[model samples]
Each structure stands twice: as C-alpha cells, then as structure tokens.
Target: MNHTRDKESILQLYNKVLPKLAERIYQNLTEVTPLFDDFRLEKIVDTWTKDRNASTDKEISIENGNVQQLGLKLSLIGFQAAGAQTFDLSKDLLFSLDYSYYEVGPDKNSRWMEKPYFEEWTSKELDDIAVKWSEEVIDEITQKLQGL
Candidate 1:
C-alpha cells in the first residue's frame, strides 16, 4: 500500500469516458424540450483529489488493510439563458456543473456559475458527470487501494 497512481493515467480515464457518459444521458432526454445533450471537451474539466488511508478494521481484526478514497468534482462551462428563454434566441447560454463532494470531514465543491445566469442545463449533463466520476474514477480506486 505504498505506490501512487500517476495523474496522467487518471486524466486518460476521465477523457475516454466523460464524453461517452454524456452521450448516454443525452439519448435518454429526447422528449418535449428542444434541448439536447452534446459532449463538449473544450469547456468541460474534471479535477480529482486522492486521499489515501491505511488502517485495519477495529471491529474485526485484520492483519493489514488499507483504503484509498478519491474525491472527484466535475465541472462544465457553457451558456444558457432564462426568462422566456429560447435556446435559439438566448443572448447568453453558458453554465457550469453543480458538483459537491465530502469525505470524512472534508468537503470540496466545483465552481458555481452565478453570472448573467446559471445555465439551465439538461438533466442528462449533470447525470453524465456523476456517472463518469463514479464509474471511471471510483471503480479504479476500489480495485487498487493503496497510499499515494
């Protein structure tokens, strides 16, 4: 439990899966509203902080057990408009993701877009970000639990 996972590997995982995640959510939101989902690598960014802990369970004595916890916050930079909002007529159409994470006692969050207006993003966008973080990032962490 003493090796660190390279940041490059983590970034690769994020890039490969983020857009796919977006597409999955987008397809599900094909109804009513003309709004649709499209994956944007340009304005999208994901940041992850790794906290590694090494300890054994007190309840059940284990020789040596270690756990690595990862906190990922995904953000989106886009544009959107409110009021009689027409995507076609909107003057501004940019917004970011609402990402909040907490581990033990520490809490980290993504930047909130509170300018011209918060982008009224489709549920798919939010859902996709969450899924990618949990799937691509969390899964790998669980597989290799070691201190970084």
Candidate 2:
C-alpha cells in the first residue's frame, strides 16, 4: 500500500476540515455568551484560534490512509477557573462584607455563582458542538478515503 497518498489525504483533511470545526465551535460559543457573567469567557471565545495548539502533529498521525490519533487543544486563558469555585482556607481567608466572619460574598449570592461560566460553556455547549463537527469531519474523510 502506498502510504504517500494516505498521508496526503490526511494533510488535506487537517488543512480543510479542522478550521471549519474550530469556526463552528467559536460560533456556538459566541451564541451562548449571554449565559455567562464573566467577561473573560467572552474574550476567550472571541480570540479562539487554531494555532499550534490546535494542530495534529507527532502526537497525532495518519495510518494506512486513515486519519488516526487526531486531537485538538483549545488553549484559553483562565481555563482553570471555569469549573467549580475552590478556596484554600489554609492559605486564604474568607471575609464577609463587614470583614467580621466567614460568610458568602455578594457574588456568591447570585444565582449563577455556583459554577463558572466558562466551565458550563465548555462542558455542556462546547462538547455538543465539537462532537457534531467531529462526526461530520470524520464522515467526510471516510468518504474521501473510500474514493482513494
């Protein structure tokens, strides 16, 4: 089997399909921006890019004309703070508005205070968009491979 053709196909798939997937994800994120309180999440969504972090390199490879080990890393700032809120009581102290005792702050009193905006967006919304886009790309590549 001539692996060169397979390699070429994989490269084509990466070049053509990956950006579309990224764009779709970006669009989905943009649509859900109103659900988040933090402006940083909106900033990250607006700046989403398919640079080095979103490429398939050595860690990902093409095998027998089939795209294998393909992966994408969506690099964003403050991604760690996206899920749940964690405070270190040993190193940090929680003070109330009057600075008397430990009490829930004003921000925590909000309905959306339980989970970070980015966390909800990534886990629920982004996951669905990514899966749908991935399946579309895979199906397209499969069709192309069949032709080859």
Worst 10 residues of 2 by lDDT: 88-97
- Per-residue lDDT of model 1, residues 24-76, tens digit only: 43343233123312222221322222222324333211111111222223222
Question: Per-residue lDDT of 1-148 in model 2, one digit per residue for the tens?
Answer: 2122244544443454334445655564453333334222111111222224334433323433322223233322221223433211110111111111112111223221122111213344335545554344345334534554
lDDT of 2: 0.31
> TM-scores for all candidates?
0.27, 0.30
Q: Candidate 1 regions off by >4 Å?
A: 1-5, 32-43, 46-148
Error of 1 at 106 (Å): 17
Off by over 4 Å in 2: 1-5, 31-67, 79-148
Supply every candidate's count of residue pairs whose N, Cα or C atoms clash at under 3 angstroms: 6, 0
Report how far off residue 109 is in candidate 2 (Å).
40
For each candidate, what is the lDDT?
Answer: 0.29, 0.31
